[model samples]
Target: MNRQAQAVVLLLLGGAVIRACFTDLYLNYVKEGLRPFLIAAGVLLVAAAVMTLWYELRPVPRAAATGDGPGQPEARAGGHDDHDHHDHHDDHDHHDHHDGHGHHEPRVGWLLILPVLGLLLVAPPALGSYAAGQAGTALASQQQPSDYPPLPEGDPVRVSVLDYASRALFDKGASIGDRRVQVTGFITAGPDGQPILARMVLSCCAADGRPVKLGMTGNAPAGLADDTWVEVTGRYSDRIGRDAVNDAEIPYLDVESWRQVPAPKQPYE
Candidate 1:
């Protein structure tokens, strides 16, 4: 790409990054901790773009001032005139070739504008039920048995889906006991078309996100479409099922009640 086109791409990309970081949009793609770094990088890119544009658009010095004007030929001393003439002819030939082909920038460079436009115009929603359905439950690696702390003091203690799944699967529901816990997450249909409460956990960003799923049973709501956010109050259960995609274990939850809710500001855990 020409320097001008490159600068425009950089400007758009930087603006997109800054916009994402300034709003809750960044949470859809990355961990909250990376916000500052993203903002800094965006600012740097914008600055670089501005500098590039300035350099490209700046006025060029007149040839007369540099003693290279057409009216002012170089005063050759000694017998170097013949060599200068030959050099000038070679320069003219090189310029003819360069002008004929123009600058050869890869066509692929233009493809970058698509993503920039997507980010600026239509930021994609966070990974939801579709992504969850495509991957196995993320609980397998975390299934190693371990001790868990007791549930917090509340009849319906609010807990994250990840925490509840960890306790139910790895700790064997020892900590959950008979307590009714409230968990919030988007719904993804299980292999049997049952509603499963699931949250995506991001170690860094959405590209590395893994789903933590809890199979819903006992009083669970039905007919809800995928990606519907909900708050579910439930007790732990021993029932488990295998993920259709990878046959990973998905622990069950004996849902007491549930209600539709708005998606959270931060979609990932």
Candidate 2:
């Protein structure tokens, strides 16, 4: 590829990497720990771009400056015979090195700008209920005995969906006791149009997200669409049973109160 094209590609790639790190759009695709790596990669790419630009812009030396002195035609011709011949051969090899072996400016290089545009113009949406349902749930680790701290004193203690699910499934609701807890999560429709409060837990990013859902009992809210974020105040129900679809014990909750709510900034747990 030409130096200009190479520089442009580096600029686009570097800009995209740096932009993703700064805006946290990277979190949609990768773990939080990857921030350092992204930053380093972006810096390297930008450095490479600057170097390429300098190389492309550097002044070319004039042939006259390196030519033989006046009144030395024979010497100049002899020198030209040796040096010009070598230069011609070297130029051919250089041309082959740069442009041969199917290394012509890759048409795919333009595609690098697409991701930058995607990040800057229209960022993609996070994974939603359809993805959760289609992918199903996968526990992060095998069931182990765990002792959870007592719920903080509150009429309706706020808790995370994963914490509640872990306590319910593994600890058998002992830690939860009879305390009423409130949790926020998006709603996923159950088999019979029932609302299942669900949260997606990620080991890295949305690609590896696994849904942690709790079935809600009591009065099912009317006109509750799928993927609607909600805050539900509820207690663990004694109606735990094996789910026929996934053949896993699905935790159920007795809903005391629920209302539609705005989605949180971080969609994943």
Taking every candidate in turn, the Cα RMSD to the unseen true structure, in Å, is 3.6, 4.6
lDDT per residue, candidate 2, 44-142, as tens digits?
999999999988888866554345456534534445663685587789889989875765777776776777677667887777788767655554344
lDDT of candidate 1 over 1-269, digit per residue (tens): 88999999999999999999998799999999999999999999999999999999988887633446577656678766745766887898899778966567888989989999999999999999999988888877764658787888988999999899888888889989999999999988889987888999999999999999989889997888889999999899999888888888888899889999999999999
After superposing all C-alphas onto the true structure, candidate 1 shows an RMSD in angstroms of: 3.6
Best candidate, lDDT: 1
lDDT of each: 0.89, 0.78
For all predicted structures, in order, the TM-scores are 0.89, 0.77
Model 1: CA > 4 A from native: 63-74, 77-99, 143-145
lDDT of 2: 0.78
